[model samples]
Target: MNATAKLDEYIPVVGQAIIDDLKLLAERLAQKHVLHVNSTAVGGGVAEILSRMVPLLGEMGINTKWEVIKGGDQFYQVTKKFHNVLHGRPDEVTPADFEIFMETSRKNIAEMNTDYDIVFIHDPQPIALIQKKGQNKWIWRCHIDVSKPHPIVWAFLKEFIVRYDASVFSAPSFSQQLPIRQALISPSIDPLSEKNRELSPEDVDRVLAKYQISRDKPIITQISRFDRLKDPVGVIEAFLMVRKYIDCQLILAGGTATDDPEGLQVLAEVKEKAADNPDIHILLLPQNDFEVNALQRGSDVIMQKSLKEGFGLTVSEALWKVKPVVAGNVGGIPLQIKHKYSGMLCNSVEGAAFALKQILNSPAFAKRLGENGREHIRNNFLLTRHLRDYMLLFLSLDYAEDLVYL
Candidate 1:
C-alpha cells in the first residue's frame, strides 16, 4: 500500500472505532490550514511524530504543512544550552547566546510566511517565531520537562510563550503556570510505523547479527540520542552493577540530531567510560525505523535512564513492543509506567540495577510486566489518540466562549 493509504491498516490495531472518531473530527477541521513549525525535520520525537502526523492529517483532508527553521551551529549550541537549562540543568546562557538566537529568529521571520488558520510551534528552537503571528491562532507545543526550569532561561522564554493563543504540554507535571490556556496532550507512537512495528523472527535476528550481538546471552539495550541528559554514563554504571550479578550484554544505540551539537562530545564520553568493555556495545545508529524496531524486538530488557525528559518516547516505544523497561523516575516516565505494575522506575544507578536484576531473574514476571505495558500503550499512547486530542484542541479554540465565570 501507499504511505498514506497504509494509515488505514492502523484501524485493526487501534480499533475501527478510533478510525471512525478521527474521521469525524477531521470533518470538523476540513480544509482548515494548519502549519507546523519546528527546528529540524528529522531526529528526536517531535520530528518523528510530525513526520507521521502531518501526512495523516493530509490523508484526513486537512490543509496541513510542516516547516523547519534555519540556523547555524552557534544557534543550535545556544538552543542546546537552553534545552539543558530548561530541564533544570545548570548552563550558562550569556548575552551572546541571546543575540545568536534572536539573529536567527530574525532571519526566519524575514524568510518565512505564516498566514494560516492555526500555526503550531514545536519546542524552544522555533518558539520565537510567534513574533510573526498575525490574525491566526498560535499554539506553542512544549515537548520538555519545564516544571523546574532555570530561572533566567524560563523568564526569558516566557516572554514569547505568553503570546500564543494556547500551549500544549505532554504531561501535567511538565506544565507551567502560564497566562494562556493550556492543554495536557501526551505524545504518541505509530504502531504501524517501522520504528514500533512488529518484525519477523528472521528480521530481528538479522539486525542482531548485523551488530554482532549474540542471542546466547540475554541482551539489554537502551536506545536514545547520546546526550548527557539521557545519562548514558549512568546507564553504563547501572549495567556494570547488574553485570556483577548477571550474564548479559549491553547495547547503547542512538543517533545524533541536527539541532544537538553536543551529541558527538557526549558520545565520546560514553565510549571513554565504556573503555573496551566487549560486552558493552555502543552503536551509533542511523535514523532507520526498521532497525530500531528490530533492536527493541531482539532485546531482553530495555532501559531509559534519562535525568530529565519530556515524555521519553523511547519508554513508550519499548512498552509498545511489550519489553519490560527500567526507566528513570523523572519527567513523563511516571505517566507511562505504574512502578512495579507495568514497568520498573529507578531513581539511581543502584535502583536501576535492582530493577534490572528483578526483571532479568524472573522471566514470568518480566513477561507479565511487558504484557501490561503493551496494553497501556495501546490504551493511551498511540498516534490515533494524539491526533484526536490535537484536533479537539484546534476545534476548542474556535468556541464562542473563551471564559465562563461562575
Candidate 2:
C-alpha cells in the first residue's frame, strides 16, 4: 500500500471523531509556525519523534520546522553527565560543567533563528534556548524521568526551564512541580515507519545475516543506544544468568547519538564484559531503521534492561512487533508493560534474568504475552494517539482553564 493509503487505514482505527478533533485543531493552528529544537538530528527517541511529527504537523496545515543545535565534544560530555544525574545517578556535575553548558548555549543563542509562533525545546540539551526566548510561546519538553534528579543538576536546569510558557513530559511521574503549567504527553512510534512496519521472514533473516547473528538458537534481543543509563552491561549480565537455564543467544544492538559522548565508552565496556561468551552477540548497528525492525521481528524474545530511561521507545517497538518483552520497571516502562499481563517488568538483574528464563522456557506463556503486548501498544503507544495528544496540547496552551476533551 502507498503511504497515503496506509495512513488512511489508521483513520478507521483512530475513528472519525479523532479526525474531526484534528481538523478543529488544524484550523486553530493554521499558518502558525511551530519549531522544534533539540540536540541531535539522528538517534535517540526525541529525534525519532520529531522526524515523523514535524512532517505530519505540516501535512495538517501547520507550518512546522525542526532545528538541531550544534555542540562540541566537551559540551556533550557535560550534558551526558547531566543526563545521568537527572536519571538519579550519582554523577558529580561540577559548577564548571554548568559554565560549559552556558557557554555552548550562548553560542547557539546567537546563531539560531527563533522566529516562530510556538517554540518547542526538547530535553535539557537545548533547554537553554529558552534563555533567548523571543516573542514566541516557548514550551520545554522534558523526556527524562526527573522524579529523583540530582539536586545540583536539577537546580541548574530548573532555572531555565521555569522561563518557558509550558512544559511537557512523557509520564506524569516524570513531571516536576514547575511554576509553569505542565502537560503529560508520552512519546510514540510511527506504525508506518521502517522501524515498526511489518517485515517478511526473508527480510528478517537478511538483517540477521548482515549482522552475523545466528538464527539457530532462540534470539533474545535488546535494541538501545550504547549508553551507561541503558545498562548494556547489565543486559549482558542478565543474559548470562538466563543462558545457564535456557540455551538462547543474546543480541545487544545499538547505535551512537551525536549528543551522547559516552556511547563509545559504554559500547567498549559491553564488548569487554561479553568477550568470553560467543553467543552474546554485540551488534553495533548504524542509524538503520529497517534493520532495527527486522532484528526485533527475528528475535524470539526482546529485552529492555535500562537502569534509567526517558521512555524506552525500544520497548514499544518490540511490543508493536508482537514479541514478548522483559523490561526494567523504571521510568515510563511500567506505563508500557502491564506486569505479566502484557509484558514482564523487572526491577533487578536477577529479576530480569528470571523473567527472561520464563519467556524462553514456556512458549505458550510467551506467545500470550506477545499477543497482549501488541494490543497494549495498539491502544496506547501508537503515533496517531500521540499526534492527537500533542495537537490537543497545542490547543490547550491557548485554553488552559477548561479541559479540552477529544
Which candidate number has the best lDDT?
1
The ten-residue window of minimal lDDT in model 1 covers: 1-10
lDDT of 1: 0.90
Score residue 338 of candidate 2 by CA lDDT.
93
- Taking the tens digit of each residue's C-alpha lDDT, what string does model 2 give over 121-194? 99999998887787778988888889888988888888898899999988777877789989888888778777
Error of 1 at 200 (Å): 0.6
> TM-score for all predictions?
0.88, 0.84
Flag regions of model 2 displaced more than 4 Å.
Answer: 1-20, 69-81, 88-100, 103-115, 131-136, 210-217, 226-228, 255-278
* Candidate 1 per-residue C-alpha lDDT over 231-284 given as tens digits, one digit per residue, 9 for 90 to 100: 999999999999999999899999977666799889889999899999999998
Clash totals, every prediction: 0, 0
Residue 401 shift from truth in candidate 2, angstroms: 2.7
RMSD of each: 3.4, 3.6
